[model samples]
Target chain A: GAGVSQSPSNKVTEKGKDVELRCDPISGHTALYWYRQSLGQGLEFLIYFQGNSAPDKSGLPSDRFSAERTGESVSTLTIQRTQQEDSAVYLCASSLVAGGTQETQYFGPGTRLLVL
Target chain B: AQSVAQPEDQVNVAEGNPLTVKCTYSVSGNPYLFWYVQYPNRGLQFLLKYITGDNLVKGSYGFEAEFNKSQTSFHLKKPSALVSDSALYFCAVRASRLTGGGNKLTFGTGTQLKVEL
Candidate 1:
């Protein structure tokens, strides 16, 4: 089976420009999550979606960061007015289901975004 | 909030030697600890996880992790190191759903493992 997949393996953009990163979760996965990995830092949680439930935006660093998932298929993380600080590898992951004891997330190749 | 800590910034071991990568975690309830590996320019690959029941959980590539509730730690280990095993390793923790925690995982600062021949 195909694992999670992310598009635009690399992106270079000017500061203040908006960028959207896409993720295609494994088929039948009901949960999707976005995370950011900055240089010399741990992966930071961004947002997550479970089925049709309202997405969990608690991890969004600021109002400029937002994510949306249409059903359980695809998810997009959008950064409005991107800042140099937003430059990092954006990773996406998905699991068979959310909040289960056996749930284990599979990750996708990240989209590296460089904001100058 | 749950959190994870990987104390060692890097671990170097000789090939054929045993290897150990330390990890500890804190959470409100039972902890679901996990280990992941990342090769350069690649996404994270799941290694193993400790959910419950067993203290020693075995995973891919001959890797295993021990869950120590008393010490609040889940350390990754392997019987023999391989040069190909060198990579960035991450430890993550999540509070069990019974505790009303969300699905997101809290990751630790990664630890680089280098296995030399």
Candidate 2:
């Protein structure tokens, strides 16, 4: 079985530039999530999508951050006008289903973004 | 609010010695606790989880976690530490009711486990 995967293992960009990070979830996984890992903020959940219902964007730090999932398979997290503070390793994960509070999430290698 | 605490910033153990990584959590409802390990420059790997029934749950890579309802803790343990076990450890928790947090796992600050030779 293929695990979750992310694009652009490393990205270096100037401040104020927008970046789009892609995620390919495991086959048949109906739930996808994005999280950020930084030196200051250990790991913070960014957004989540379950099936086709409304996505949970409560964890998005600001309006500049948004994500979209094409159906239930692929997801992209975009950070508009990126700031130095936004530099971090963006991680994606997926699970077999969405509920029961016991679902295990398989994680991706992550995209390391560096805002210079 | 659901939360997890990994009080120790780091834990060091010699190879062949027993190791423990402490984790405590808080939630409005019953908790689903989990443990994960991360090596440098890699994604996190699931070690084990405690949902119900068993207080002691064994998982991959010879790792196990004990769920303590009274102490609100789920600590990862290995009978004999190996140098390869050195890595960053994270503990996470989710509420059973799916309210408040809504299946979103809350993770700890993480603890660095250094297994020496």
DockQ of each: 0.92, 0.68
**What DockQ score does model 1 reach against the true complex?**
0.92
Candidate 1 per-residue C-alpha lDDT over A1-116 given as tens digits, one digit per residue, 9 for 90 to 100: 89999998999999999999999999999999999999766699989999988989989999999898998899999999999999999999999978798899999999999999
lDDT of each: 0.94, 0.91
Show pairs that collide, candidate 1: none
Which one wins on DockQ?
1
Considering the two chains of model 1, state its CAPRI-style docking category: high
lDDT, candidate 2, at B106: 83
In model 2, how large is the Cα lDDT of residue A5?
92
Compared to the true structure, candidate 1 yields what TM-score?
0.99
TM-score of chain A of each: 0.97, 0.97
Where does model 1 exceed 4 Å of error? none
lDDT tens digits, residue span B4-96, model 2: 999999999999999999999999877889998999999989988888898999999999999999999999999999999999999998888
